[model samples]
Target: AYFKEKGKEVIYDAEHFFDGYKSNHAYAMRTLQAAAQGGADCLVLCDTNGGTFPFDIFKVVQEVKKNFGIKIGIHTHNDCGMAAANAIMAVEAGAGQVQGTYTGFGERCGNANLSTIIPNLQIKQHYICIPENQLVNLTKTARKISEIANVTLNERDPYVGNCAFAHKGGMHIDGVCKASSSFEHINPERVGNKRRFLMSEVSGRKTILDKIQEINPSVTKDS
Candidate 1:
């Protein structure tokens, strides 16, 4: 009431929402109701412990949307290694916004990874969140944030990882070399990354062919 003297919009975050909903569904719904009645502009459901699965997150968010007419948001952590997955699923179930960090950096594992989420939503899912040009700088942006935070970037991190598009297996190498989309789900270049073929026992001739060409574009298969 005091803060809203100027008609400022307020958001109410229901922390530990999954746990609270599980413990007492009525109380959790009531909390959201109270916030809406009190003029909250948005209601964010937090996965405080970060243990809820993506399916559960989707279900709970669906329920919240069904019952409340206010804008719905979601906050997730990576304790179960599903923060990104859960966030995506929640959006699928009608969440308006997803709260996350650059490299999923935060307390108790970390938050959802916007690095992974942004591209997935914009490029793959075709959701309009940011400018199209913003997608091109995702990889460099992730690395920069990681550097600023003094955290080693995960090579296997989706979309922006060094190894996200690396192919090693003989079959995979052959397939990707023939057609990149065969073995890769998304174009690495779409997220400012390039495809890589790691030299290994399983590497195929095509792998060497591609690498040789990368090193010296003039080199041909006959040579």
Candidate 2:
């Protein structure tokens, strides 16, 4: 109320909100009501311990959105490896904003990975979280940020990971050869990654031809 009277924006964050809501639902709602009555500009629900499941998050956020007329946001951690999923669920249930760290790196188990969340929300869910032109720079930017932070980016991280689009074995390569969509979720080029066909014990003639065609597009099994 004091800040609102002074015309300063106040974003009240409800930390450990998930646990609090689970422990005492009515009390939690009352606390949020107090913040709203005090003129909070926005209310951010935080999963401070990062242990809540996605379903629980969805339910709580849904109820909050229904009761509060203010902007709702989500802040999650990755201790349970559900940060991105929980964040996405919150958005689905009506969170207007998502709080996360780029490349999913932060304290303890880290925060919700914006790298994963951005693509999932933007490309998959059709939300406009970033400029359309900058969407292609996701992988490169993640790498640069990881390098600067001296944190080795996980090669298996979703969307920006090196192995995210890599295909191996003869059948896998053959499926990808027949149709890029067969073995990939989204195009690697769309996010500045590349499709890799690793040579494996199962590599077949079709796989070899596919590799050769990379160097010489005209070369084929018939040729």
Q: Which prediction has the highest TM-score against the true structure?
A: 2
Question: How well does model 1 score by local distance difference test?
Answer: 0.89
Model 2 residue 24 CA deviation (Å) reads 1.9
Q: Model 1, clash count?
A: 0
lDDT of each: 0.89, 0.92
My TM-score estimates for the predictions, one after another, are 0.92, 0.93
Once fitted onto the true fold, the runs of candidate 1 whose alpha carbons sit more than 4 angstroms away are 212-218
lDDT of 1 by residue, 53-115 (tens): 999999999999998898999999999989999999999999998899987889989899999
TM-score for candidate 2, please give it.
0.93
Best by lDDT: 2
Backbone N/Cα/C clashes per model = 0, 0
Pairs with backbone N, CA or C atoms under 3 Å apart (clashes), candidate 2: none
